[model samples]
Target: MAKQKIRKGDLVQVIAGKDKGLQGKVIQSLPRDGKVIVEGVNRVKKHTKVGQTARGSQTGGIITTEAPIQVSNVMLVVEHEGKKVVTRVGFRREEQERTLPDGSKKTVTRSVRFAKKTGEAI
Candidate 1:
């Protein structure tokens, strides 16, 4: 399996296509397909066939729901210079767990930086 930089729940914005400038949380990521489903983005209507035995005899209508957009068309939203900016993945040095003065260990987290601009971690 190929490793994917973007994961579910990551806030991303559409950088191209009809949904450009729209930002939403990632519902899922399909690395194999190079596509991602975002909340409230690239919404398309889905039609469902109604059956006679349906509850309340309600007729199904067009349902608007988000569809997956190509990963290349979206950019991850990150913070930069006190402002929100699109960012590409850049890894920092891995840090080990730190022990506090009170004898407690904390999970270490590395900083995330912009791929093109800053070299420093988050």
Candidate 2:
């Protein structure tokens, strides 16, 4: 399994491939395949034959929809200083001392995703 940083509903920009430079919100994330489906990106046309659905008889023709793009090919977008910018994501872990019910102190580490360029939490 691949570690997934980009997730569904995240605004991302295509960093490579045929759709390079296009930005869109993530519609789905396939962590198992390290791929994500972004809205309005990677559009592909599919020809379909006549078919019937539970709703009723469906009209089928050339349908355009989004296709999956590799997770590594997209970068998350964030607002920085009034401008939308793309940045690499970095994880920051901080340990805090917490007092248990028995009065014993324990350290707990929390993980956060931040933009590497601006150091802003996302």
Candidate 3:
């Protein structure tokens, strides 16, 4: 599987579907499904039967909640200049030196995500 560019808590803008152009923070990321649930976007109504719970409390009715949308339909939002703008995400590997218990130094590479538009680490 490929690495997911969008993660939970990222600000993103919808570029397709009925919620196009809407910006919201990502509430959840489903990398396996290639979908993300954004706050205040792709809302869906769910109906349930009214029934009693173990505590005898009523628990069932119409509920409105966010629905997952395709990851490709959204673009990551980042601060560029002095304004917020949507941009593509890119990955870069950074190397760092680490000291071992044997008094030896080793170099390790880690993947980092960045905002392509501003070339800034995210």
Candidate 4:
């Protein structure tokens, strides 16, 4: 599996495709397929036949919903200065000292993500 940089509920902008320049929040991420479903992006319409079932009556017609787009097509949106900006993401390892139960301090390394532009945590 690949590392997922774009997570759910993240605001992103479409960099390619017909929805270029459109911005929306990520609703779902499909890391296995390298795709993500963003709010109001890559919408597809489906037509269904009406049927009666035990659960409920189905009267489906033309329904539109978001579809998955390649992860590379979207970029994370971050607030910079007073406006939103798009930048590449990078990870860093930070070392921290922790006190164990034995009263001995041990150094631990943790992974952190930040924007490559301003070095701000995502």
**Whose lDDT is greatest here?**
3
Give all TM-scores, in the order shown.
0.71, 0.83, 0.88, 0.85
The Cα error of candidate 4 at residue 120, in Å, is 0.7
For model 3, residues 1-122, the per-residue Cα lDDT tens digits are: 88899999999999999999999999999999999999999999999899999998999899999999999999999987899978999999998899999999999998889999899999
Q: Name the TM-score of candidate 1.
A: 0.71
In Å, residue 52's CA in model 1 sits off its true spot by 7.7
- Residue range 1-122, candidate 1, lDDT tens digits: 65566779888888899989999999998899989999999999999786565456766678888888988888888767797777876656566689999999998876554445544344
Among residues 3 or more apart in sequence or in different chains, the pairs in candidate 4 whose N, CA or C atoms overlap within 3 Å are: none
User: In model 4, where do residues sit more than 4 Å from their true spots?
Assistant: 53-55, 97-106
lDDT of 3 at 38: 99
Order of candidates by TM-score, top first?
3, 4, 2, 1
Write candidate 4's Cα lDDT for 1-122 as tens digits: 76988989999999999999999999999999999999999999988787777888667678898989999999998999998999878889988899999999999998988888888988
C-alpha lDDT score of every prediction, in listed order: 0.80, 0.92, 0.95, 0.91
